[model samples]
Target: SGGPNYKVALGRRDGLSYATEEAVLSFLPSPTSNVTALIDVFTELDLTTKDLVTLSGAHTIGIAHCSSFENRLFPTQDSTLDPIFAENLYLTCPVINISSTTVIDIRTPNTFDNKYYVDLLHREGLFTSDQGLYEDFRTKPFVIIFALCQHLFFENFVYSMTKMGQLSVLTGSQGEIRRNCSALNSNLSWYAVDGDGHDGKVF
Candidate 1:
């Protein structure tokens, strides 16, 4: 759980408008994306290859739904996925649409660390986008460096995350600051849950 501490500049203004689902999907890399696609998406945001791999370390702390990686398991296994890890994934997700989840980082899932890079080295990365880091020449070096030296990973992560925070940022008087960060100041009901109460969909 312990990780690097970096100073983040304060008083960053919140956006008045929320991103549309289509806009978000268009900009972000997909779970099954290759390193090239990842690089392209990040580059469009003015992020470098180093930023791509560094920011990817955030995967060390989240859980991914089985649906995100089922393609690599069903039909044919991804050659990059470790056999033992693949078997365990099969146990959790025997078939597609099973509605299960697993930690993104097989090792140190709760920690913000370079273990995600280590996972890539072992071919245990949960997503194609992740494993593809090791498969690509551009990103593989950063992966190896992060795997071997966690301090460098932490240092780079802080820089990349800070750089990312500056992108598309709204400046003074450009946007309103809502009392509740989740919703607009005028509309408290930012999202609606279906009858099943499973997920909140943004309007």
Candidate 2:
């Protein structure tokens, strides 16, 4: 499939750093976070507001475990959530700690499309972080632009994904590879994208 491209640089080392619970919480944004908080997390990774909204389109085909959005149902539902949408989610999630899941996109849960942004425009966003895009003036335009045209969303998503994949990456034996390098590789499929230099290149 010919599209906006990013190069693949192989043999990069993976980081093994692990921090304490407090430190971990300091960086991870909550599902209920607002635009400001969500943008803060993206900025930490050099992602832009446009990238945040465009990448959010992935939710079109996404699913979330009950634990992920259960809080919205319990402890009084979130005011921003559409009442009809929340009611349906309650039926799916039912009681606290019940094991279940729900789709992010109400219109089409299995397509890579713009319906996620469309849902946000109707205040039907599943997560606070998602709805924050429409509620905040700074990011609302990107949501409208993507919702109106999926091709635009796809183009921006490719660039954003390529950018994210290159963050602090270590190439050319700069770090250690703890696992087997290639002994068991014959069991897996392999592919390589031959390409010229690009800012999106990742290992």
Best by TM-score: 1
**Which pairs clash (backbone N, Cα, C closer than 3 Å) in model 2?**
none
In terms of lDDT, the best-performing candidate is 1
Please, what is the TM-score per model?
0.86, 0.75
Candidate 2 global TM-score: 0.75
lDDT at residue 164 of model 2 (Cα atoms): 75
lDDT of 2 by residue, 1-203 (tens): 22335565555565445356998787678887889988988998888989888877778887888887777788898887889998999889888887788888999887667889999988888887888899899899999998898788878888888787778887674553433454232222342223652222125
What value does the lDDT take at residue 107 in candidate 2? 91
